[model samples]
Each structure stands twice: as C-alpha cells, then as structure tokens.
Target chain A: MIAEVLTIGDELLTGNTIDSNSAYIAQRLTERGYWVRRITTVGDDVGEIMSVIREILNRKPSVLVISGGLGPTHDDVTMLAVAKALGRDLVLCEDCLERIKQFYEELHRNGLIDDPTLNEARKKMAYLPEGATPLENTEGAAPGAYIEYEGVKIFVLPGMPREMKAMLEREVLPRIGERKFIQKKFLAEITDESKLAPILNEAIERFRVKIHSSPKGFGKFIGIIIFAEDEAKVKEVVEFMEGKGIRFMEGW
Target chain B: MIAEVLTIGDELLTGNTIDSNSAYIAQRLTERGYWVRRITTVGDDVGEIMSVIREILNRKPSVLVISGGLGPTHDDVTMLAVAKALGRDLVLCEDCLERIKQFYEELHRNGLIDDPTLNEARKKMAYLPEGATPLENTEGAAPGAYIEYEGVKIFVLPGMPREMKAMLEREVLPRIGERKFIQKKFLAEITDESKLAPILNEAIERFRVKIHSSPKGFGKFIGIIIFAEDEAKVKEVVEFMEGKGIRFMEGW
Candidate 1:
C-alpha cells in the first residue's frame, strides 16, 4: 500500500509552527510497509489545498493522511479542502453535532472552564462533511473525521500533536495494517567510495538485494540499506558486504 | 521568495529516524519571508530522487534546500542525486579534499582516534559536482555544497541538525537577506462569517490581500488571516471588521 501526507497550516508554511505531525505519520506508515510517496505542506488557502489533493489523487495513493486544521480558528480548513478535493459539499452532520455537544457537556461536568471560546471550538468540530465517520477524540475537543471516497481513504485529524497522534494510533493504524513490508539498514565507515565501488558492484551482483549506497563526508563514514521482501535475500547481501571487509556500524 | 524543501533519507521515511532537518529549514526559510511551498522526502532511490527534484524545479521554487546523503556511508547518495538532478558529472575537488584532510587532522589532534571508518567518512565529503561551491562545516567532517543551476539555487546541507542549522544561519540566511517581503496575520473569533464575507471580499478588491476564513467551532471562534504588502491596509481591514462587531482574537 502507498500513502501520501498533507499538512495544512499557515503556521507550518510561514515557519510560525514546526510540522512534526507529517514526519511522525510518514514514519509510522513506512514501518507498516506502506510507502509514503510524497508529503506536501501548503498554507490555509483552499485552492492550494484542492490543487495538492487533486495532484496526489491522480498519483493514486491508497490512503491520504492530512494533519493540521480542525481548530476553531479561521485558518483551519482541512475538512473543507478534503471535501472540495472529493467534489463533495461541506454539509454539517447530526452525529458530528451530537459529538460536539457531548464533548462540551463532558468538559463542563469535569469543571473545565466553560467559555464562549470553548463552545466555539466544540462547534467547529461538529461541522463535518456529510456521510463522514466522526472519530472519537479522547485527547481533545476536536473529533476527527474519516471519509472513504473514490477508493481512497482520507483521514482528517486535528492539528494538535496530542490529538492527532492519539486518533491516528487508535483509528487509522488498524485500518492500514493489512500490508507487509521489510526494511534493513547497513552502516559502514569507508573513506574512499571509489575504492569500494568495485566491491559494491560485486555485492549487488552476487545477491538479490535492493541495495542503496551512500558515502558520507570526505570518506569518514559510509552506510547502506538493503530492502527486500525476503529476509534471507537481505541477510545474504549484508553478508556479502561483510565478507568484503566492510565493518558494520552501530545502528544496524 | 518561494522555497521547496527536499530531505533525503531512508531513515527519515522510515520510523527509525525523526526528520528535524526539514522543520529547521522551513522555519529559517519562513523567517526570511520565503514561503516554503512544499517539502518532499525521498528514499535513496535515484529515480525517485530525480523525479522529486524535477517536480520541485517545475514548480519554480527559487530556492531548493536538500539535506541528508552527506555521510561517509555506502547509503549516502545525496551528491549522486544532486548530480543526476542537475545533469552534472561528479568531480572530486582538490579544495574539498584539503578540507577533508584538515578535518581528519583536527580529529587526530583532538584525540578523536583516527580509524579507517572515520577516515572514510571524511573522504566522501570531498566529492562534488562540477562548478559547485563547497560550504565548510566546522561542526562535522562533511562540508556542504551549493550550486545554482537553471535559475534554481540548490543548497546541500548535512542531515545532522546542529551542522545544518549552523550553515543555514551563517551562510544561507545572509545571502538571502536582500529580498523584501511583508508578513501580516489577522485573527478574529467566530463572528458570523456570512456577515464578514462581503467585507473580506471588499478588502481583497481594494488591496492585494490573501484572505482565508476558518470556523473554529462556535459563533465567536472564527479565525481569519490576511497577508498583504501594506501593513496599514492589513490593520485597516482588521479594524474595519472589529467596527462591524467582529472581535479580534490574538495573532492580529
């Protein structure tokens, strides 16, 4: 399976905020054997968001994960963008409204300060697209929404790291857990890449491995990663390089 | 100015490594009033790297900041990728070689203990594409390279945050300081967006304002921002909205 990540926020694009969400999502998706082909960041502009979503959809990733937006603020328009990308209308759903009301009541019962700002934030969560499945947010007031349209599952989560991370772990990962993939890394310290060129060539020829060679600065360090579905094939390639007098480094 | 960020690494795409490099670049670029349009992360695959570089170029981003693949390891193929993207041949520069040698000598003097592994790391940093300008890295053995090809200024920095941040702050930012841009942000609570919609339209018609309105969940928790060249015009729009009973939130 393949996925693409879209992080929507002016803060990220303008450098007011750091985007740790996309990185975290990409890492998790890769570990699950899904290739995240591209990651995009754009301002809160709906047109830009729509263009990016359309472009990535044409590329046809099975899943598209979007983080940011989902706040009760003016720049939070991720859900709107997703709907526009799918050519769907931004319709407020009854379930979403109930979710928002329940969330507010819970907060009020918990003696959390009840203010207009909090209510507004809760109301924004209630305004989701029609036919969208609202994901429960145990971490924050913003309830995440998931919509499967055009054979692509679009997961819309809040911009807050705590909410996004929790929802992704609870709601998204399980749905994407069917695929299998293997990753192997090789680290070696070699100064002269030209000298090792012949050995690297030989190793690739000797073993059926997807080998990638990267030589670090002025010849002080070298690392390689061989990825493949077959563990034996991966090990064989690593063994071949080890036989060539290549010493492995700390991180496998 | 507009910039695109390309952070290359299998570790970054994988869950094992967290990519703090792109965020660092994005923050620095945004601070300089440069809009980071997109961030692309690719594995060590040469074809994928080439495609991403081409796509970023097609978007006409003035600056392209790339990190990773500068290590002295077999997997480090950033320089090779740069060469392929720029259609340049890799050449070992004598100046870079001398820099590498000096770095090794410094390590030895500091009792860092020279090993074959360490020497190999330094050697890989010496190779660069033809006509590339080598940027020195005082923190590490790998020296970064910068090259302007076909109107796009490409910056190749180390993946290590400390080294990359230093080079960016010292070398990159100063060179980009000549450009002029003004950033304006406006925030308002959820005041009837319908009522403010026409006013925003009028403001956009009068001044070159990039206006975006997002609902935050309640009647008073709407957020909006206007980016424009004129500071006075931006403030006037906010004040106009405030006079229309639109409460200004923080970030104005």
Candidate 2:
C-alpha cells in the first residue's frame, strides 16, 4: 500500500517555519510498511490546496495524510478545502465543543486563566467535515480529523510537530497495520563517479536496478541504496556485483 | 509564484526514514516568497511517481523540487520518471563525473576508504537526464540534479537532510530571487469563537477576505491569518476584523 502526505502552512513556503510535521509523518508512515511515495507541502491557499488534494486522489493512493490549516485563523482554510475535496459539509462537531468546554473548566478551576477562553477555542474545534471522525488530541487543544471515503483514508492533523506526532502515533499508525518490506544498499569508496558510469549502466541493465550516490567528505565515501520487493533477487543482484569485486558495506 | 515539493522513498512511507529534506526545501521556498503550495510524499514506485508528478504539474506550480530516489538502488527510479515527464533522454553529466573522481581522491587521501568502494559510489552518481544541470553535493556523494524545462524549474536533490540543505542553500535559493509576500495573523481573546463565527463569515463574505481558526488552547487562545499580494490590504483585512472585535495576535 502507498500513502501521500500533505503539509499545509504559509510559513512553510516562506522558509520562516521549517516543516517538521512532514518528516515526523513520513517516518511514522514508512515504519508502518506503507510505501510513502511522495510528500507535498502547500501554503494556506484554497485553490492550491484543492488542486493538490484532487491530484493526489486521482493517483488513488491507499491513504492521504494532511497537516496544517485546521486552525481557526484567517489563513487557516485547510478544513474548507478538505471538505470541498471530500464532498462533505463543514459542520460543527458538538463532541469537540463539549471536550473544549470541559478542558477549559478544568483549567479555570486550576486558575490557569480567569477568562479561561474555553468557548472561543471550542468554537474553533467544533467545525469539522460532516461524517468525519475527530481524532482526540490529549496533548493539544485542536483535535485532528479522520475521514474514510471510498476505501481511502484521509487523516488531517495540526501542523505543530508535537500535536501531529501525538495524533500520528495514537491514531494514524494503529489504522495502518504492519506489512513486509525489503531493503538493499550499494557502497563504494572510489573518487570519480564518471569512471563508474559504465558500471552503473551495467548494473541497471543486468539487474534491472537503480542506485543512489551519497558522497561524503569530498568524496571519501559513497553509499547507494538498492531497494526491491524481492529480497532473494536483490541478493542475487548483489552477488553479481561481488563478482565484479564490489563489496557490500551495509544494507542489503 | 508557487512551488511543489516531492519526496520519494519507501522508507518515508513505511515509517523508517524521516523526510527532513521536505521541510528544509519548504522553508527555503517559503522564505523566497514562493508559495510552497503542495508537498506530496510517495514511495519508489515508477508508476506512482509519474502519476504524482503529473498531478503536481496539473496544479501548475511554477517550480517542482524533488528529493530522494537518486541512487544506484533497484527502487531509485525518480530520474526515470522525471526524464519521462520531460520527454528527455537520460545521459551522463561529464563535469559531475570529474567532480566525483576528485571527491573520491580526497576521500582516499584522508584515509577514509580504499579505491574499489569509491569506484562504485562514483558510478552511482553518474547517471543524469540529457540537458540536466548537475548540482554538486559537497556534503554527500550524490550530485544533485537541476533541470529547467519550459517555465518550470525541477530539482532533484539527495534525500539526506544534510545534502539537500547544502544544495538548496548553495544552488537553488539563488535561482529564485526577490519575490513579494506578506504574512498576517489575527488573535481574538475574551470572546467565544462561535459568537464570532458568524461575524467572521460575514466579514469574509462582505470583504472577499479569508480567515482561519487557530485555536491554541482548544478554545482558550485563537489566531487568524490573512495572506495576500498586498501587504497594506492584508493589514486592512486584519483591521476590518479588529473593527468587528477580533483582536490581534502575533505574526500579523
């Protein structure tokens, strides 16, 4: 199975805010055995959000995870686009309202703040797509949104790393079960990548493979990942390289 | 201008590899005033990669930044999809090859490793699409690929955060210069969001404005952002809200 992650924020595009959400989500998704093919980051523009979401849906990914723009701020329009894409009405979730009320009441009881600001926050969290399941956020105020339509699961979480991480671990991962996977890698310590051009070509031709080059310290060491679904075939391909005197340093 | 970010790797999806590269790229793009509109994460499947790329293209982002899958690995086919997307033939960049050789020699001189491994690593970085510009990775073995076709700029960077950051800062940012942008945020305290919801809706409808619900404490604190081409207009929109009793927060 495959998944696509979409992070929403204008701050992300301007380089003002580094999108830690995508990295966290990507790592979690990968560990769950879903093939995370592509990650997209968009600003809080409705047209852009709608366009990207529509495009991802066309690819028919098993799942789509989105972050940011669920806030009740002026630029926070992620919910709107999500509702538009999923063909759902953006209605207030009463359950979310009660959760907010109770939370503020507790905080007020503790003298966190006199005003408590509970209803204001609750009103923001109350808005959700019709029929979307609200992912409880025990750590933060804003709850994440989970919608399953047409057998494709779409999870929406806050852009804040802490909140996103909590929801992903507590809610997202459980929905995606464990699956099998294979890993492979190729390593070389040579200098001129051009000299190995023919070799790379040959490997691709013979094993139907593609290799990545990770050169470190002015080309002192290079690591390449050779991945596949078939572990045995990958081993066979590595053996062929070993025949040509290429030794595996790690990952196969 | 709008830019779309693409991160490729099964590791990202299966929850093994954290895609920090996307954040780095998104932050950089955002700083340049280019809306990092959509970030799509996909695995190492050729068909899926192609489909997602096509989908991003359909969104008509001015630039596309891609990271990962540029290895000598069996699953690293990002270049192939890119080549196919551009209808170009895959070829080797000779300068990149020479750089790889020099990189290896330095590595060997520092006693990092022997020559045989260097040979394989260099080979891994040699493949390129015809007419592509090779962006040397000083931090890693894989030389990044930068291709400009039509009016869209497409960059292929190593998945490693270090390599991606190095190339993006040294090479990509300079290419995208001086774009205009405005960042605005609005805060409302001592008021219920539900009371202001109808007002916000009316304000948006009356003035053709956009606002998001950024509830910080689930209902305790709230923030709204309004992004526009005109900084003055963004402020005007915020003022319009304040006129309606929505106070100001930070980052306006």
Which one is best on lDDT? 1
- Candidate 2 structure quality by residue, lDDT tens digits, A32-63: 55656667777787887888788788778898
Summing lDDT over every window of 10 consecutive residues in candidate 1 chain B, give the lowest-scoring window.
Answer: B113-122
Docking class of 1: acceptable
Model 2 TM: 0.71
Interface RMSD for candidate number 1? 4.3
For residues B101-203, write the lDDT of model 2, one tens digit per residue: 7776777787865663535534657778788988879886668888887778888888877778888889887777765445566556734556666777776
Interface DockQ of candidate 2: 0.33
What is the C-alpha lDDT profile of model 1 across A1-252, one tens digit per residue?
778888888767655566788878987787576777777777777888888889888888888998887865555677888788888877776676776677667666766534434344446667777778888777776778888877888888888788899999999988876654466776677645667767777876766334555544434456566656568877776777778877777464
Per-model lDDT: 0.73, 0.71
Quote the lDDT for B29 in model 1.
80
